[model samples]
Target: MVAADGGTDRASALVTSAKFSEAAQRHNFEAGWLVRDPWRASTVSDHFRRLVANRLFVAL
Candidate 1:
């Protein structure tokens, strides 16, 4: 979950969901979802590098 200033909030929510739900935990880990704020260049750059290195596609 990536948003301008709400990335942490969104990620936290997902984490909470996974914490309580077995299906959510499996899907979350399998999907490898992460939170990144575009304003944070370093984090975004790191995510981009990982994606490229893994040959992964961004859903959005």
Candidate 2:
């Protein structure tokens, strides 16, 4: 999840706590990208490009 606030620890903790079933069984749960607001167009584009390159987007 891309967060406007770059609080990776908080995001990680939230995801960690919300795990259930298959998610809970997986041990590799991790908070991925964290992008702050006031983003430039190039920066957003670059991030999306990288995510796509890495096959990170399941949709969009």
Residue 13, model 2, lDDT? 12
Off by over 4 Å in 1: 1-39, 57-60
Task: Kindly provide the TM-score of model 1 when superposed on the true structure, using C-alpha atoms.
Answer: 0.29
Give the TM-score of each candidate: 0.29, 0.31
State the weakest 10-residue window (summed lDDT) of model 2. 7-16
Which residue pairs in candidate 1 have backbone atoms (N, alpha carbon, C) closer than 3 angstroms, thus clashing? Answer: none
1-60 per-residue lDDT for model 1 (tens digits): 332443343222111223447776666654434444334534664565588678795645
On TM-score, the candidate that comes out on top is 2
In the predicted model 2, the residue pairs found to clash are: none
- Counting clashing residue pairs in each candidate, in order, gives 0, 0
Residue-level lDDT for 41 in candidate 2: 32
Model 2 regions more than 4 Å off: 1-39, 58-60
- Candidate 1 CA-lDDT value: 0.46
lDDT computed for candidate 2: 0.45
